[model samples]
Target: MPRPYLLFTQHGWADTNQSMMALATALTAKDEAQIMAPCLDYAMTWLRIAPLIDQVETLATATLAQQPELPLRIVGHSMGGLIWLEVLNRHPDWWDRVDFLVLVASPVGGADLGRILDPLKVGLGVAADLGKDRRPLAGRIAAAINTLTIAGDIDGGSDGTITVESTRVPNAQFVYLPGLSHAAMRCHPQVIEHIQDFWAGKRLSEPLIPHPLVNRLRQIPGMTDAHLRDFARSTPWHTFTDGTSIHLWRSPFGIDHVFLASAQGDCLYAGYVGWLHGEDLRRSLDALRGEPELLEKPIL
Candidate 1:
């Protein structure tokens, strides 16, 4: 007989476990999987995330101790996904047992809004923790586990809260639901259907093909991907030979936001860097100036 599934569903910031539990129930209606949905304090979510992580870790460890042979399936929404990433990073031994992992509307790439709230990174409540980028850790975990990232694109780029670009992770299958909001993702029918399909050996979405300009921008340290909705406000900075254009927008806080637009004026990529990475971004762009194929005419 096949081993029973030990399913875990986690809710995000300012959310109760009710929606996640409902989702867990819907997912396991046929398989009778064991579900673990912890009710984290809603008020406490405004604080640091470490304590919340500790609570879930302790519960999961105890449950696993009792059922050592059960296979694992995890579903985390928003901050819940971030918490699971940290937990898995702390326990590599749990990797082999994770049959599947699903992150719904989770910002794996540091949240831009979070950084905007706490621009100085001074641990101002939960902003500092939420602003942290966990892609490297997520990439390592994805390399070892069957991972799926589901994002909501209500505004062509964001889920009304987290940017679609911020939900991306390396080596993971990605699914984006149109007109879905961040809060709606926790129990959205389409989101549930996609998850069910993914588990049944169906490919619901394709992996994004890497773009050369985007790849180079990703290499620059401390860069956080932003939403494309703000691209209209940015001024054109440079235009490349391939019709790719770069735009710049400085935030009121003096942070530099960059946008890469395609030949047809589509926002291909958008990212921002804090004061610390200002020089790095400048030097990287200057280096791109020397590449003839990349730069044809300067619009600055």
Candidate 2:
């Protein structure tokens, strides 16, 4: 007989554990699973995230101690996903026990709105913590665990809050559900369906193969992904040989924002760099100009 599931469902900032609790029940209705859905203090969520992570870790550790052999299946929404990433990062020993991980509308690339609220990186309530980019840590965890990321795109690129781009990470399966808002994602039926598919070892969609230009842009120092809500204001600059293109937009404060678009006019990436990495961004763009394969090509 297969080992029973050791399941965990975590709620995000300013959220009660009720939604996740319902999610947990739905996910394991037919299976023999032990579920742990901790109700974090809603008021405390407005502060830092470290204390919250510690709280969850303590509960998880004690639960594992009792049944150390059961394979783990975790589901996290928004901040909940970030917490699990931190927990998994601190305990590599627990990596093997994690069978599956699902991040529902989590911002793995950092929350763009959070950066706006705390531009100076000050500990402005929970903004600074929410704005942190945890992709590197997520990448480390994904290498060892079977990971799936579910993002809702109510607009062209965002789920009314989290951008689809921000939810992406390397080496993980991605499911993009159009027309779904952020709050609706918590216990959406489609979200549940996709998670069930993932648990059954099914591919929800084709693996995302990022454009080569995206890979190059990511290597630039201090480059951070941004939301596409402001993409309409940007001006087209250059189009590459592969029909990929670049657009430019400068904030009133002189901050540079860059965007990547496909030949089909679909937005592929939106990112920005602060003054510290301005020079790096320029040099990277200049280098791209010299490469014929990535050079400007007129849109026909």
Candidate 3:
């Protein structure tokens, strides 16, 4: 069983519950923990920022009211942590209520690229306004909880998007994985130990695994070497002609949610999809590239 914590999982960009389910299974091995992963879209998507902020506040308030006895702990992956930070910024009082906050391969400050492209998104109207204001959001959240942050040095200082400098908060405990990629560090056994130790309020003695490439993957948009390491555990081939098949394996490439459309073709959608087929679609997305692969998989 996992520890008796709220176990709120914040996934990366475009991710739904697909990635969270795998994490919940691993973290709750002891069975003592109950995890709740909500359906969250990209923070920049889904209308304006106020509504998005309200979404988390509403959920957190409900969770706090219902599970008063259970220690509330939050774990966010990538942009998911960014959303969590947004929530905390709105309601700082909730920070004291939380036990521990564990951010896996999360870009706390801001993704280096985010700084560059964010303007384009806002300018071209591709995404909602996500400015430097989000950077301070994480710092505010850290003030509320016993925050623990993990960053990968594989790509300078990014899990892939947010830079390490972006993730730095004034008082939060920080750990830098010199060689692990942003996403790969999520599956590293050392990451598990750090998460568990923080939950138990213990300090980590040594990293479980300190493989390099953590920061190296920052060079690419969706190619995290950490995915290469973690990929073997689920499926060797991620790109598949069939979207459903791709979801069977954990996706190494970054997407919001993994999904396979009902369309009849030798292709699997790579981007975002609902539950069930999330893992199934990621299994077959090994061949395609960029956003096109996100929604439609090509036949091999």
lDDT of 2 by residue, 217-298 (tens): 7667767777776677788888887788888898999888888989998778889888777989999888886778553443
Q: Output the number of the TM-score-best candidate.
A: 2
C-alpha RMSD for every candidate: 4.1, 4.1, 16.3
Residue 120 local lDDT, model 2: 80
Candidate 3 structure quality by residue, lDDT tens digits, 78-151? 66676777777777766777888877765554443543454334542213333233534555566657888887
- Cα lDDT tens digits, model 1, 1-300, are 235889999999999999999999998878858999999999999999999999999999999999898889999999999999999988999999998999999998888788878878899888889889897788788889989999998886899898999898877899978899999999989988999988777876665444578767866766888878889989998888888888989988898888889999988889988898999999988887568765433322
Query: Candidate 1: misplaced stretches above 4 Å?
Result: 1-3, 219-222, 232-245, 249-255, 261-266, 274-280, 291-300
Model 2 spans > 4 angstroms off? 219-223, 229-234, 239-243, 250-255, 263-265, 273-284, 287-300
Report lDDT (CA) for all predictions: 0.87, 0.87, 0.54
Best to worst by TM-score, what's the order? 2, 1, 3
For candidate 2, the 10 contiguous residues with the lowest summed lDDT are: 291-300
